[model samples]
Target: LEIQKKGNEWAVVLDSKYNRRIDANTKMEVSGAAKKEVLKDKKFAYGTFANCANGQTPWGTYISCEENFDDYFGSSDENLKFDENFKRYGFKTKSEYGWEKFDERFDLAKNLDEANRFGWIVEINPFDAKSTPIKKTALGRFKHENAEFIVEKDGLVIVYMGDDEIDEFIYKFVSKHKYVKGGDTSKILDEGTLYVGQFNGNVGDFRGSGKWIALEYGKNGLDESKGFKSQADILINTRLAA
Candidate 1:
């Protein structure tokens, strides 16, 4: 995109500028049944807010987490019944911002599925000013505190994240594909497996052994019998899935 200034206005010169293909494409194909209905085939959502922490990827992009995002959405209906999933995420009848009173998107009664759209880890290309951020749903949605990226010797990328809420959980995402240097890195983030952490030691042990529990669907009790229908369901209801 070549730009020219003309009389206090900016205009594109109709020139060609190749944009990077780094978007994770997790927007339209996101999780949550009701939330999917609201975002069906849509490439974009509202936005990411309440992000207080940040991270950097090995590909030189920036990672911004959506922390305390649940505070912006709430139920307007006084008699609205909160489901277990909603309760697990701590959605209340009132919110800190009270956006539900004015914005339909923030009102749970009017748009209950909207809450599911938030609480994600958003990736941004700092080099591209015109680039749009992508919400990496494979990383599992929650009140993200921070994300640390690591590229192993085998070229696999691992992202360790922490949920800010007390007594919540710690999670890590391992990419299914390997990272190719200077190669196409667009979909590497979307193709991965998220895992939960489990400590195995005494209560007073300072250093304890731990294991990474895979949160994939169909494994263990994560099948439909336990109310998890798909990988999307496990990722969406990460707290319960853990």
Candidate 2:
């Protein structure tokens, strides 16, 4: 339904009305690009290659995550090959789908920088295919399997996500704003904080409910020196930032 690229910035295939592409020059406009002009770079999706693993959002939008990216491009080492990170999901180092052969951008080695943009949760509004899809980096950049939503009693937002690879972490993003019930989906989603979880408990903790900790920005023991410059920065490099 929707497609996207992840990196320090985010990009989406604008609905058919505003659809755009990111060549060697364009940057993406994912969530959290308020400052530093990180969203200026726009390399939109080429017609050739497309990513997968999509689900529908409550707001009539589609969420898609890119998996098994190494196969798209030529990787010099096996480390870059589909590592354990990709295994948790349903991907192998060798891609059965030969999209790369059709598009040069599909090749990871040729577009090494692009590789950083994959493995993210992309948001698409099928109703408006003209609008560009966006990569919500606040969700972290990994082999994402799902982005399911569960609203709390107070109308706060909570998105549950799985890494899909072995030993990968499950994460959630609790919104700072309450759900409008019928508000503009696109506008509301742009504002929220991303968080990762670490299930902790002794023998009992493992079996019972796992505590949910908010991966605060520069709080709860995050480095201040090389810390996230803005919410955009946090969303941009969520994987590395965590």
lDDT of each model, Cα atoms only?
Answer: 0.79, 0.57
Candidate 1 local lDDT, 1-242, one digit each (tens): 34689999998666436333332222223432233533655646767788868999888888888889778887878888998999998889899999888878788999887787778888887566566677778888889999999999999999999999889889999998888889788777888888999988765657668899999898868999999888888878888999
TM-score of each: 0.83, 0.65
Q: What is the number of backbone collisions in each predicted candidate, taken in the order shown?
A: 0, 32
The candidate maximizing TM-score is 1
Off by over 4 Å in 1: 1-38, 203-205
lDDT (Cα) of model 2: 0.57
